[model samples]
Target: YTEDEGFVYLNSIMDLYSRKIIAWTLSKTLEVEEVLKCLETAKRRRKTVNPVVIQSDRGVHYTSQKYKELTKGMIRSYSRKGNPWDNACIESYHAVIKREWLNRFRIKNYYQAYQLVFEYLEGFYNTVRIHSHCEYLSPDSYEKKYILEQTN
Candidate 1:
């Protein structure tokens, strides 16, 4: 995300099943710490009983020692080389975020970009925007429906 000040990187983790953004962190730089922070936030937010297999592109930030150490007990999966489709969901999401939301605003700084993205994820994307794969339900609705089916 490029603001008037500079480029800001937005790191996010989405729940694969529902296409819901479980956690995110925005920073001015692509430091390994930002990646770790996003993962940690996801872990704390989800607290899923099922084992987690984090699928990420083989970016330097993901390959860093800090990330490896932080994910000590979690499963880490990487997209296959030369096959970006393996992670198409998240990849497509990046485009949608930029196209459908961020591009609409002339973000002045990191704060402005961050606030807009935060609103998009919480107010619109997860709650209002529908996905065809989810039977045209928003991600939050999809997750709730899935949970209901499981419990019943």
Candidate 2:
């Protein structure tokens, strides 16, 4: 979220395991409702989801009253101040997203960027992109393998 092009807000929830962008929402403003909607989207998609420990920077959106009220008891929140390493996992994902997808393209508008981001996350990153942590398997494949191993 930046003021580069008339108020852009990018909110995303990422899994640390395979660096998967589980859910995200891009909006024209940093409204609490928009943030809530993104969280709801993540919740709906996950079956047998674990209660998460969400770590983020001390951004206004993450520290807002609405977020605290909405997500109370559902997830434990942690914030980092002036240290990028505190949220290293998601920071790494962000770096990759920007370097590989967002930075390469000329996004004429917010909607176009939104669509491109969504497609990259679902179609490429989660499904096909190999990660070092998973020994070169994509997030989805790594998750499946982990579940299989756990059940066995």
The candidate that achieves the highest lDDT relative to the unseen native structure: 1
Model 2, CA-based lDDT: 0.78
Instruction: Give a tens-digit lDDT track for model 1, residues 1-152.
Output: 55577899889899988899999999999788898999999989987677878899999988888889877778998888889987899889888999999999888998899999999999999999999989999999999998899999
Question: How far is 137's C-alpha from truth in model 1 (Å)?
Answer: 0.6
Lowest-lDDT window of 10 residues in candidate 1?
A: 1-10
Tell me each candidate's TM-score: 0.93, 0.84
What's the C-alpha lDDT at position 127 in model 2? 98
TM-score of 2: 0.84
lDDT per residue for candidate 2 within 1-152, as digits (tens), equals: 33346546678888787677888888887687887788878767764455766666777767788778766657655655676787777777777888898877777777777888888888898999998988899999999999899999
Best by TM-score: 1
What candidate 2 gets wrong by more than 4 Å, as runs, is 1-7, 47-50
Pairs of colliding residues, candidate 2: none
